[model samples]
Target: MNGIILPVDKPAGWTSFDVVAKLRSGLRWRKVGHAGTLDPMATGLLIVLFGECTSSSDEFMDLGKQYRGVVKLGVTTSTDDLDGDIISERPVNWDEVLVRNIVSSFRGEILQRPPAISAIKVNGERSYKIARSGKELSLEPRPVKIHEITVVELSCPFVTIEVTCGKGTYIRSIARDIGELLGCGGSLAKLRRTSIGDYQVEDAWRIEDALRVPEFRGQR
Candidate 1:
């Protein structure tokens, strides 16, 4: 294959690079790249590029994203997700009306602070690295547009939300902010990227299948 655009359903516990590396080694391709980075805890659509497609990464990355996630109210964590240590806890006494209002408040463009344990670079190092060194890491909030945010379900401490947002939007930050507004700390309990632009997870290849069929060519 000269150049191919592969949509992969990235499995949880595997970094985005892991997918590219696996495909690169298995397919015996020299150049391989990914459009976006999904955290180790996140699972869903990850666009993999090959050969000439590698050069068009930014075009794919700039597209909007959609995610379905669960936010745990009244609980805060180090990484803003279940993968981190507990930082704080509080009581939950919020109703559906209040929850809906709070979640929907984030629909428009807003300044969002990226998680400290993110891959974002600070100074000359990764923010997560500085945080791991036991030093304070300050990250400035930047503008991110959330096209839509709907409450899929609200069950006590867990609120399931589906989000459609532009680039640079952090679902973890939305979870944290939602918790804060409800007067209770919160963190992301679950997250799955369902789509990116027109690319859907349903059409993506599973890691196992992709590795098993290296010769399979996908739409570019």
Candidate 2:
């Protein structure tokens, strides 16, 4: 296939590389890549690069992203998401007004620490690798911008929020922070990327259907 940016709706439980590998085999070719990875537990828009397009990652990687997620309050997970082990829990004491106000406070720029089980590198080794080895590291917090955070629903233990933020923002971090702000622990229960700049998940090509249709647009 030639060069093109293909929008794929990544399925949950599949690593970003899994989608790339699936395309590579089904298309009987190589040179496939993806921009802006989603965690294995999150499903949504994944922009894929094909053939010569693999060289254009920077174009999309820096774009702002949007995500809709559910934060499970009163519970803390090692990974900040359901994929990790539950480390602790606390009693919840929050109301809709408090939740809305707390979520709104996250708007604008803020510092966030990426989860230990993340792709971030420390001394050339993935942080997750180090974390899985039973070693603890005080990872530095990085600046990220949250343009907007809208609280969609508030039901005590479950808080749903939609976030519009810059490239480096982690929804899991937002959940954890929100929980901390409310004096209760928190973790991401579900997450889905709705958009990245101009690309929307609604228009994304389904991996299952794409594999069956041989002469897709990416074909040479």
Candidate 3:
């Protein structure tokens, strides 16, 4: 049995589970699993563990991650990203100076509330499942560290940002919290995971490409 580490560039519209399923089938290994979960609307690097490599999943999970994203101000969604129900919309006049200031405030330690429609478990059930059933899910704020946050570009309501943060930090939550700080509601318009610790997206193989490799096909 080979313990190979595969980095996959997950495309949008496919859940993390989808990627794992495809890898499992392609590699013919029932032991394949991913280090972290990325939402269907997001794309980028996913570290996949196969065969005997599954033992290293915890090491990859602890590594920091970097992401680039666009937050669309003036809109608030139930999920904090583009996938969920739109809760409200308001006018936003985002200038470079204003955006810079808001981005600055997010650096260092911060408390963030996870979106109601998230994978967080509450009372032994996923929060999103509870939220989708029309039940109110109240999530407590947790401490998260933002190592760095920079405003990459700005165009009216759309502000692009690059963020590097600790494990388990949610970029969507950062957008929503930043919007609150600026008095304009916001939600993630786009997101891409650029890197995870020392692993860059450039090194990741596409799912289709990984499937064609004979070494991957013989894992089962």
Candidate 4:
């Protein structure tokens, strides 16, 4: 078999690997992998590759991604998202003009530091492991391309935005930086990946459905 590319609408609370494992078990495929990793708190399009397709994971990962997310202002966290412990709180007193201006400033290329509680490797070990061990790791900022960011709405402490970015761009970091620019810390409250390259969540399968599809079931 040449294998297949399966677009999955990954539910929250499941790691990217969890999706791969489920399919591997259900379909009994020897080789299965996911192109990109989404935080457990996030839900969205996850590209699942099987068999020979697994070899092309890097190509899928390098494609641009789109997301819709909500950022909560006035609070910072150990991680850059709601999954982490709260580190601080501040008053959110800002007008829409200021918020919009600052949010728009993140357009184009920018250096962003990955969250400590992330999959990035530090000294051959996952950075999150180091963080969980009660140690601090200084991660350097790297360049990522932000194609576009639109402020969808602003309701007091919550700011909603739609983002299109290149590989390695973290929306959580964008929220964190925006809050810093607004004089109040911010953390990603909610996130949903909408698309990757031409693949959209609209066409993705829920885990259970994918496992039961006639074509996929027949492949086994």
Name the top TM-score candidate: 4
| Candidate 4 lDDT tens digits, 61-97 | 8999999999999999999998899999999987899
> Backbone clashes in each candidate structure, one number apiece?
0, 1, 0, 0
What candidate 4 gets wrong by more than 4 Å, as runs, is 218-220
lDDT of 2: 0.90
- Residue 159 miss distance in model 4 (angstroms): 0.5
- Which residue pairs clash in candidate 1? none
Q: After superposition on all CA atoms, what RMSD does each candidate show versus the true structure? A: 2.3, 1.5, 1.1, 1.2
Candidate 2 per-residue C-alpha lDDT over 93-205 given as tens digits, one digit per residue, 9 for 90 to 100: 97889889999999999989888888899999999899999998757999999998999988879999999999878899999989999998899999999999999999999
- What TM-score does candidate 3 reach? 0.96
TM-score of 4: 0.97
- Clash pairs, model 3 backbone: none
Model 4 CA lDDT for position 143: 98
Q: Estimate each model's TM-score.
A: 0.96, 0.96, 0.96, 0.97
What does candidate 1's lDDT look like per residue over 1-220, in tens digits? 6788899999889999899998887776788999989989999999999998899999998999999999999999989998999999999997999999999999998999999998899988999999999998868999999999999998999999999999888899999999999999889998999999999999999977887873754333
Give candidate 1's error at residue 82 in angstroms: 0.7
Candidate 2 C-alpha error for residue 55, in Å: 0.7
